[model samples]
Target: MTSLDLALIQDAYAKLRPVVHQTPLFSNRLLSQLTDCDLYLKAENLQITGSFKIRGALNKVSAVAQTNASGVVTGSSGNHGQAVAWAARFMHLTAQIVVPTTAPAAKVEAALSYGAQVEYCGTTSHERLERAQQIAKDTGMTFVPPYDDPLVMAGQGTIGLEILEQRPDVQTVLIPIGGGGLISGIATAIKSLRPDIRVIGVEPLGAPKAYQSRQAHARITLPSTDTIADGLKSLALGTQTYPIIERLVDDLVTVDDDEIRYAMGLLLTRQKLLTEPSGAATTAYALRRPAQIRGQKVVALISGGNIDVPTLCHQLNP
Candidate 1:
C-alpha cells in the first residue's frame, strides 16, 4: 500500500495548481453568530465542476494519462462521476462512469455532457463499484477507485493546503464525509502542518459509515443507507482512507436529513450560497451543536452544489 504523506500532498498541489481552482475561504457574520464561533466557509461548492472532487479527479486522471491505458472507469454517486468525466475529457482519455440508479439526474447528465459513457447500476456505491471494476477488466481500462487511491487522497489534500493558507488561524475544520477521501486528505494535511487544529468529519445520520467504523475500531460496511445527500451514501469508507482518517481526524459526527435540509436552506437564504445536502452537512453539525465549537475559529467545508431544482425546492420547502 502506498503511504499518504504531506510531501505527496504537496506534490499534488504543485501539479494541480495550474488546473484546479483555489476555492475561497470566506467568513459569514450571520453563520458565525448562529454557531457562536468565528466561522469560515470553504466554498468548494463554487469550485470547477461545482465541487472539490474535481481536484482529485484531475490529479488521478493526469497520472493515468501518462500510462498506456486506453481509458478509465469508476463508480460514483454523483459529484465524483462528473469530476472524473470532466477530468478524463481534459486529459484526452475516454471515460466510463458507473453511477447508482438513484443518483441525482443532474449529476448524471453532467457526466454525460462531458463525453463520458454512463452506466446505471444498483443504488449503492459498492454495487456500482463492482460493475465499474468489471467494465475495466472487460475493456482494458484502468479502474480509478473513487476515494481509495493514494493519488486521489493526495489530490483532495490540496484543499487542506488551501485552507491553511487562506486561514492560518483556523482552529477547527469541519468537512463532510463520504467514502472518507475529503476528510482523510484534509486531516492528514492539517494534522501534519498544524497538529493543534481539530479536524472533524460530518456525515449523514442515515449513512454514518465513518462514525460507525470509528466506534468499531475497524472498517465495516453497512447493508444499506438512507439519506438525502446522494453523494454521501457510500456503504463504507475506502480502505486507504480509513486508516488515515483514524489516525489524523479528530472526530466524526452525524446529522439527520432534516438538519441537513435546514442547513441547506439557511445557506441559500442567509449566506447566499447554494449547496447540496452533502455540502451543507458540516454546517448542519455546527448549527445543531453550537456550544461544542463556541468561541473557536471554525472552517466548515461546503462540499458541492449539484442538487437538482426539484430536490432543492423540496429540501428548501421542507
Candidate 2:
C-alpha cells in the first residue's frame, strides 16, 4: 500500500492552496427539506477546471516538473484530462491528453483550449491507458496518472480537510467515486482525524466497479459502463485506491441514471448549481436511499460541472 499519512496530506494542502480554489461548502435549504437532513453541498463543480481533479493533477504535475521533465502525459474520460492540461499549462510544460472517444465534447474542448494535444482512444479505461502509455513512451514524457498515486490521493485529501474546517459538526460526507481516488483520499483523512464522521461513497449502478470489487474482494473489470455519469465510468479500481477505500470508507451506495438525472435537475433548478451527473450521484443516493443517513448533517461532493448543453437540456427536460 502507498504510504499516505496526515503529514503528507497536509503538505499537499499547503502546496495546493495557492494553486487551487478552496471551493465553497454551503447548506441548501431546499435540499435539506427534501432529504430531511442538514444538507451541505461541497460545490467542486465551481472548482478550477470545473472539477476537483485539478487538485491531484496539479499535485502530480508539480512533483514531475521538479525534475524538468520534457512533457506530461495522462488519460481521462474528461475532467482529469482538462485538469492535467490546465495544470501543465500553468506550469509551462507540454501536455498530451488521451481521452476516450465517447468523452464529453465540452471537456475535450476545455483541454484543447489549454494548448494540450488531445488524442482519442477507445471507450474504456484500459484503452485510454494504453494510448497514454504509448504516447509517454514515444515522447519520453512524464506520465501523470489520473489516480492511483499517493501524492494524488494526498492532494485530494485536502478536500476532506476543508470540509471539516468548514463544518466541524458535519456528521457524514457523501463523496462521489470514479476510480476511487476522491473517496479514498477523503475517507482516509476523515477517518484519521474525526473518526466519528462517516464517509460514504456514491457510484452509478451501471459502473459499480468499486462496489463489485469490495463484494468480490478483488478488482472486477466491467465489460462496459452504461451510465449517464460519464466521469464515473472506470472499468476497474486502482490497486492503491481500492484498498484505501475498502478500509477507510464506511459505506458504498449506487444511484441509477434516472436518479442521477433527477438529482442533477434538482441541483440546477432548486439550488442553482450546475452539477454534472457524476457529481450529482451523492445527492441522488440521499434522495433515493434516505434511511442510511437521515437526520444527519450531510455534505455531498459535487465532482464536476462539465455536462454538455444538449445533454443538460435532455436531462432537465426528460
The prediction achieving the highest lDDT against the true structure is: 1
TM-score of 1: 0.98
Among residues 3 or more apart in sequence or in different chains, the pairs in candidate 2 whose N, CA or C atoms overlap within 3 Å are none
* Model 2 TM-score (2 dp): 0.98
Q: Write the per-residue lDDT of candidate 1 for residues 71-175, one digit (tens) a residue.
A: 999999889999999999999999999998888889999999999999999888888999999999898999988899889989999999999999999999999
Per-candidate Cα lDDT values, in order, are 0.91, 0.90
Please provide, for model 2 over 172-192, each residue's C-alpha lDDT reduced to its tens digit, 9 standing for 90 to 100. 899988998888788878888
Task: State TM-scores per candidate.
Answer: 0.98, 0.98
Off by over 4 Å in 2: none
lDDT, residue 301, model 1: 97
> Model 1: how far is 119 from its true place, Å?
0.6
